[model samples]
Target: DGVGLMTAADVSAYAHADDGGVEAFVTAGVDVRGWAARPGEGAAGVQDPGTINVVVAVPAALTDAALVNAVATATEAKVQALVEGGYDCSGTPTDAVCVVADAPGPHREAHAFAGPRSLWGARLARAVHRAVLQAVVIADRDGPAVRGQA
Candidate 1:
């Protein structure tokens, strides 16, 4: 048997969503090297890195807590998309995510919450979910083998 590796990203996706005056933009890339497996369910040894990277941007300012929550919210959405795509794993071990938002001005109140149930959080989740889903589809179309999988 042999492991496969693609130097470039296997698939990438982007999506945007807005609720009320809040907006979220998301971009994602996925590359699974047949190492996809549910956490704690895969082989113990380390393998070559295959990553899923997602970046989310928002135009509204948020509190520090909200920013942390946004990262969690985005991750949750990524897992949801992976599950929906029939992938048996939450994500590759090397997966990474980033969330960016405007900084609050001196006189402005930053968003206090960014949970999936919150207005802005919901928008963020939706955008991330859609983008990840799209990436999954692209990977499928390109074939699992090309993604370094069987």
Candidate 2:
């Protein structure tokens, strides 16, 4: 249930895009509904506590080669830009972001899912990891009878 809200797949998927549009699309999904976007402007350092949330979606089932290539492509300028632009966090400012993708279907060519670091990327990753685990417990508790429905 909560895992749905903590999906990092998008960041991973777009990180590998050849044209480099992940930040734009991601910012749109993660920002105020009526907000605007500025080139080189990412939500790297900014965070909203409590009710805060991030949404990441990406494609899945990619070949090892493709993923390696995608990582090479995403690592250079994408991660560098944030580092240069003054992203900050307990982790490298770039650690707030993480990408994940899954491939499931009859058949298709392989694709890669890549995620670059976020400003607070590392922190977000850690938090999500823990939150996801708890969500599983919560789901089970509510399932049959663990006495939890909150």
Candidate 3:
């Protein structure tokens, strides 16, 4: 899986959202730590073919609708980044991102954030829920060996 962000340095550079070139924009005013990508071996995220984790700057309202909306926005942005980086998700960008509960029949995982919710908490929740559920399915799965990766 991968990590996602609204203001990713690489993506911002790739998107070239700034008036200046990517490096100049990044070096002058970007958060060096800002990044968006699929999670790595030790990080927390949904385990699937190519899932990504992300963070977005959300307002303080903390509405459920707002949360969902933030998720949607982050999802699209992340998927687009992936596509630009060469993910062939067809023309449906949404297919690359979805609510964790609705995994589109593919094994996946994701964390939610409410403006100021701690990143540690969200990632922990996603890891626990997704891992446990996938483990349950694996244990119950028949005619296949259940093994964990990462």
Candidate 4:
């Protein structure tokens, strides 16, 4: 019912970032225009199909709290990318994100925090941001005829 962006198939991007000993990898698939909307700007309770999907992986082990914090950081980075790319909305209603971190080892210390200011969190955010930005740029370049399908 609205203008489409990027082809519905294989429209994705990947980005990686490293800081100190922390490393992060991000993969993003973005196909939003018909469904893009800010958190409070769209219908109050509509759960649409997920149009933007991001997967973030880090090499360092993280505590439970850090894991949860990584999710928030990634989401924020995604929103930042969308906004920087000229998208009026934060993201599609059903945007999905998955975060993965190494399992704690006997010798490895688990990080307790993964906020934007934290070392690992900062790398994760940059990686996610770069991946999302690449995806958004691809969508914009592809114009308003394709919607991420395949």
Candidate 5:
């Protein structure tokens, strides 16, 4: 059977009253159709390449630039988790990453307090990493044939 990994996170940040605080909820998952026994090796008995997808919901106050930064931050964190777990993607990952954010509301004021270096980014990375790690753990416990094969 194919393997799949999933995790999620919810975080919030306080901005000035004028900027209005922001709340971010992120849910991310990594799906591995298949994997090889070793990194950079042929598929052999592994499944197809993996893909990452995320869903983010925030108040309308957030800006487009901030949203973009959030997506990038989340993706980088996902890749970092895979690498730290010993999967060498060689900077070319076949994984498909998707991040969706809700439309802005009128009550909140958009604020780009921090880019990818803010507490918001850190929280997002942690959430994505946690989810990916959970998936990896499941894959490892299942069997040795699929172990460490991303």
Candidate 6:
């Protein structure tokens, strides 16, 4: 299993945004664990043991519905990453995601909206994508057996 943590500050540095969306900062962390499946088996054929979780800290400007949408966007991005990496998650993966608003900041200004198509949501997706990719790399390096004998 591999775990990756990314803070809003980290994203800010990575995106090189003037504010990194710091005013409405969102932090996303991802844990990705992999399991081996029988050879030649498709996604449904594997008894997958992989799991994914996303935790987020958002600014107060975000709404409850927006929070929920953010979770969905993160989840979709995680699954997309896993699939792109050739993991069969159809049978044996669990994905859990949660989002919480931060205390009122100096701005205290609410966002117009949030969702996968929204700017904030896109940022959240990018953060999650990087984290999950990091975890996968770690898993690959540490455990050759987990992904099937080399």
Please give each candidate's TM-score. 0.70, 0.28, 0.28, 0.69, 0.53, 0.55
- Better-scoring candidate (lDDT), 2 or 5: 5
Q: Which stretches of candidate 2 lie over 4 Å from their true place?
A: 1-56, 68-74, 83-97, 112-150
lDDT of 3 by residue, 32-114 (tens): 11224324523455423222323322213234544575455444444343234333331121122222222222333333442
Tell me how candidate 6 scores on lDDT: 0.49
Residue 149, model 5: lDDT of: 41
Residue-level lDDT tens digits of model 6 in 50-118: 444455555446766676777777677666666665554421234455655554457775564556668
Range of the 10 consecutive residues with the lowest summed lDDT in candidate 5: 10-19
For each candidate in the order shown, give its overall lDDT on alpha carbons.
Answer: 0.67, 0.31, 0.29, 0.67, 0.45, 0.49
By how many angstroms RMSD does model 1 differ from the true structure? 7.5
Better of 3 and 5 by lDDT: 5
Lowest summed-lDDT stretch of 10 residues in model 2? 27-36
Itemize residue pairs with steric clashes in candidate 5. Answer: 34-47, 35-47, 60-104, 60-105, 61-110
Better of 2 and 6 by lDDT: 6
User: Alpha-carbon error at 35 in model 6, in Å?
Assistant: 13
How does candidate 2 fare on TM-score?
0.28
The lowest-lDDT stretch of 10 consecutive residues in candidate 1 is: 1-10
Question: What lDDT does candidate 3 reach at residue 116?
Answer: 19
Q: TM-score ranking from best to worst? A: 1, 4, 6, 5, 2, 3
In candidate 4, which residue pairs clash? Answer: 8-147, 8-148, 8-149, 8-150, 9-150
- After TM-score superposition, the amount by which residue 65's alpha carbon in candidate 2 deviates from its true location, in angstroms, is 4.8
lDDT of 1 at 117: 96
lDDT of 1 by residue, 1-150 (tens): 222333334433444555454444433344443334434655568755456667677778899999999989988988888768766557776666777788899876799999999878988888888777766665556534343232
